[model samples]
Target: IPFSSTTKYQISIHAMEEGYCLLAMKGAPERILARCSTICTESGTQEMNDEMMEICDRACTELAEKGERVLGFADLVLDNQYTKEYPFCAEPPNFPRKNLRFVGFMSLIDPPRPQVPDAVERCRSAGIRVVMVTGDHPVTAKAIAREVGIISYEEVIEAFNINTIETLPPNLPFAKNKAIVIHGAALRDMNDQELDRILYNFREIVFARTSPTQKLHIVEGCQRLGEIVAVTGDGVNDAPALKKADIGIAMGISGSEVSQQSADMILLDDNFASIITGVEEGRRIFDNLKKSIAYTLASNVPEILPFLAFVLLNIPLPLGVMAILCIDLLTDMLPAISLAYERAESDIMLRPPRNPRKDKLVTRKLYFLAYGHIGLIEAMGGFFVYFAIMAEHGFMPMQLFGLRERWDSESVNDLLDHYGQEWTYQNRKELEYTCYTAFMISVVVTQWLDLVVCKTRSNSIFKQGMGNMVLNISLVVETVVACMLSYLPNMSYLKFYPILFRWWCYSLPFALLIFAFDEFRKWRIRKYPQGWYRKETYY
Candidate 1:
């Protein structure tokens, strides 16, 4: 949800009720949102209406019952005393995508370098349009645009004469298409109302001589268009816009502490390049989160399959408590940790910025791939282990090897002893304990192999790369420590690891099978036109 108001005097309460449970005040909107339940409220020059107060009462009641929190205004108040004794600040909205416009005060900095052209080109190629908003004179803004390589004469030659241009001239021709430059003269006589009217026509607009209030107007106007606007500012005059934007971005080095406080993201280096880098990092983080979800949901499949098969068939249960422990802790977690380091794919940025309306978990195809194909491979590997034992040792293998029934049922133990083994119920318990140990060991090795498999698709494991070396080393070291810890008898606490050297040899063929599957997948993807990694694609 997004909103903007021109006046600080009064705002509709409906806007304030749009999902914020807690309201922290450093601005009029926040103050209004915070004081929704009060009979009357005032912050800065703004005041609340009776209708607003009524809405606030209902909202407060709803929030209080749910134990939802709202804080960071003048006084700290907990929503529900009984359910939530502890006070907590409101959590920031978790938007799937963020859209920000950087209004460069043209004369305030160095000329746009050659890199600016390439950057602009890259942005447009990535479907991010650029607009140059400046307080400078029209001629100066045009000159800068030309030198920056964003404007060509063909885009200008047939247009009105430069001498004829005046303050508050009608909207220019290329406003809907290529990059635009808004100069002081083009809208100097225009008040907030007229400026907003002009700005509404262009999806993105740049302006010069924009005041703090004007900046706020720009932010509000963008919000009206349903954009997830982020405002970047350094001057004291920029505070209103900084506070008004959906997410405020501030310069850490040269910007005032007030600007920094008002912002959600701070640019430590205070370079335009840093903003691009931040965007890339944000995209990667979002992508990795999707990967993590995929990893977790897929690992659950193999853990549940054998038990389901056991119950449906009259056959005895195959997975013991120790085995379940092994699968859950050792087999499942390590590979997931390794997956966290998967490099951002080449198309991550090439794809258009995700729609702001989308959910945080944006990549559904990848998740399905993880859960469907990858989980099937893992289940097959486990089934192969079960079958290998059954074929070699006969029916005794089924009685002794199944980890689930061994740990959970005593009847299963009696059945195992009935198979002509010298073991009593006590000895069967001890062997069950050993089965857990072996399971844990297998789980750990299998998880490591899973990590190794995920790291390479068509490529050999040795030829594969961890794009981020520092992160890769950290994950590898952590996995090694976890693998060692999974082997401890009691420390393995769940008795999940049962390392059998002979059985371990089977892992090589299972891994090779995954390799073949990956190679086939890669080939099919490359053969299709819409495939993300099809021929001539950029990395």
Candidate 2:
């Protein structure tokens, strides 16, 4: 019936053994009740003494320091037979089963995969913390943590070994600034209040000799102090804390069914770098979303002002409905879409993590900067083009006032200019189309200038450079598309015609004016951090 005649097993598993059993119950300080064995040795059944106990302890420490999971074994003395209490693996139904000899320990090391260190560094740059919890010797846990950048590799190894500390500091637990390694037994002794203090203050921490319940305790303690927690696990034991974390990340390839069921997300490759990539991508998307909104709003003030002025002042319509549609739906769309391809700000990782309570997507500063300042400027520039064109073409700005009613009359084609020149319906329509083309060119050309300014909230666009390929290509595409909308003949839907070469020359100064003005505004904001302009307009 027996495969090995000399085998006699004594085992107790689950939380009580996996978490609490120490030294294989051989040298542990528990009461003894039975003495039995199936194997006999020549050296008087393998004696348990001080030297043998030392060897077991040394074996555990060595394995742990090398990041190994050490298992314990014990020899049972054969003097009396005992009834089996636990099934599968049995032990005598009594405390500290009698006459146990300390058999040496064995270990397993699951070497960490490559790229984990770089991923951890990225998390640190983004202001995320990493903590290690393991049911292994403190030395072993500390060793692995150090290898992974969780603990500094340059840290003196001697400083981490607590027992070797011939002189203890006043704050015994936190003497080392680089890292603090806690033993599981010592952690079990600490109350939640003490745990919270350590977690709140320490920059680096390693929790060793932890049980399944201790890991749960660590997650709960961090949460109680208002920290967002994310737990990673692959075993059934990790299920409880995985479910408790704000974001539970499970290893897909190696994870158990229960862990997969509990996790908020799973990593198919099981590489920690994926998490860092996610953080980077998420931040990039949020910044681009804000950029697109700001860019879209910046032009709306100018587009809508033409109608408002016509309704109130009754001036001849400077911009018709078709012209507005060409600018809004056709010419301006590409550049606004291009804003979505902007790269992350240069200091995106260097800045402190944004405060969730204070930072926001839209704010008074954004509104004032986008609508009240840039938008107003664009509106004024558009109107100036209309005024300049009319003034030079034999009509003063004053003469165009209150002309909306007559300008719209189908039969009124002999409208006279300041030079006493009568114009037929066909001739006046050509002049009107010329003005419309000038207005369209003004908005399109000016918006390209605005796009450069919109690239950064504060920094110089030249300093950031134009390496974003999507945005660079979109710039080329927008230029071509806008040219077609304004210059190509027979654009009946847009009521547009080819703008004169002279109008292009006229627009150069206005576009330059917008760019120089924004540059000056940026300079003042940078030079005077507390200035009112920077405070209200630093979008």
Candidate 3:
């Protein structure tokens, strides 16, 4: 017979000169021992009495407690008279399976991989509960779980009273510090509510002698408690749970095709340590993505505020439409993409798993930091440069207000400046382009500081290191591109114009201010970790 979760054993028959002989029955020790009616003693087969059964059970328990997987073996010899009545064929007639002679026990030790203990410790430190579910006996499972550090020796001692609860109660006397080991037979009898209660009560759990169906139930029970579960398996019997879990990791080397197909991810090396590496990479990517988003969004205010000023305050547009396109597509692209290459600011595995519901990629605090804080300062920088350039050319900030209609009019050949200087349309148009260049320069400069400060949310730039070569190269490229857009000939069609070197110098203070302000914010957050400043402003 083939091995199954239900049968828990396999049998084979052989042809002998005397008759057909069933060579072996190998499976769960208890299941195989239960089917035997006679025991093979030193002299001959003897009736299996309660005393013999107790001795066999005790031996199996001892082996299992020693962290060995135990299997029982039994066989029977049939005479010619029995085979003659039920002749052997491709499909042999059913023969009596009872009264078989019980064989001695066999045990094998399979130690866990060396790195598994450290990986399990990392999971625990990360606040991820590691549960072991296996078809092994309860004692064997508990022993291995302890060896792997899933449950400590002290927890096992505390939970020894109810180590194997045959029946679950409405209210378990489970303490928060205690760990529990449950038998699969008891799990089979548990309803959904009782299973949920069991899962809720135990932070560390071990499920022994579990069937495929029981594994699926455990996955469902965790999901019902709003926990995100990731299950790993390598056998066909594991496919159901693998499919049901939020994330299913399949072992490529030993895993069945069915399990791999059902899994969300595959571990090619089949090492458990790879899973911790993946978690660290995932957290780093999430942090980098947030940094990229914040960097990208902060420039939106500087771009939009110029147009807003043109419409509401009736001032000449500080930034042109083409300039906004250049900022988004050219100067900002490389820096944002380079954030993905940034190394982790800290040991990401030391932090608890982020709450999916409460902690998001983009929060209100992120928006406030991007638009209201950093972006607001960037917009101010752009406007300061715009007005300074305009004032130098005889158009005062106050005089530029409510001048949009006349400023853009094609028919107005001459316009009066604050100094009463007359300017034709072409002259004023060149001045507008200069102002556009000035504002774009201010945005680009301030964002350089923005990118540096955004690299680490809680760590200072000096501590985080300015060592992302990709980002450093991107900043150099941004400066080159900005210069090209400003100084390149025939670029006026894009509303870009060459500005004096002093205009570049004017935006430097604002850029430094951005760096200084963000550094101060990070310092405050680090100094007073539990303060309201961190709660409200530390995005």
Q: Per-model C-alpha lDDT, please?
A: 0.50, 0.69, 0.87
lDDT score for candidate 2 against the true structure: 0.69
lDDT of 3 by residue, 1-539 (tens): 66888779887767667665655678999888888999999988899999999999999999998889998989877655555345554334365555678979999999889999999999988888898989999889888898899887466522222334434344556446677788877788777987788788777788888899999999999999999999999999899999999999999999999999999999999999899889989999999999999999999999999998999999988899899999999999999999999999874677779889977999888998899889999999999999999999899999998999998898888799988888888998899999999899999999999999999988889989988999999999999999999999999988899999999888889889889999998889889988866888766
Model 2 ranges with Cα > 4 A deviation = 1-55, 77-99, 153-178, 183-194, 220-226, 341-346, 357-360, 398-433, 456-460, 509-539
Residue-wise lDDT of candidate 2 within 68-125, one digit each (tens)?
A: 7565555542222222332323332343454555444557677787899888887788
What's the distance in Å from true for residue 214, model 2?
4.0
Best by TM-score: 3
Q: Residue 85, candidate 2: how far off, in angstroms?
A: 13
Output candidate 1 Cα RMSD: 20.3
Segments of candidate 1 deviating more than 4 angstroms: 1-110, 113-122, 149-177, 183-205, 209-213, 253-261, 326-335, 338-348, 362-367, 396-446, 452-464, 467-499, 516-539
Candidates' TM-scores?
0.59, 0.76, 0.91
Where does candidate 3 clash, by residue pair?
none
Instruction: Please give, for residues 216-280, the per-residue lDDT of candidate 1 as tens digits.
Output: 76678667756667667765666778898887888888898889888888878676566656666
For model 3, the stretches where C-alpha displacement exceeds 4 angstroms are 41-51, 84-93, 157-173, 410-414, 523-539
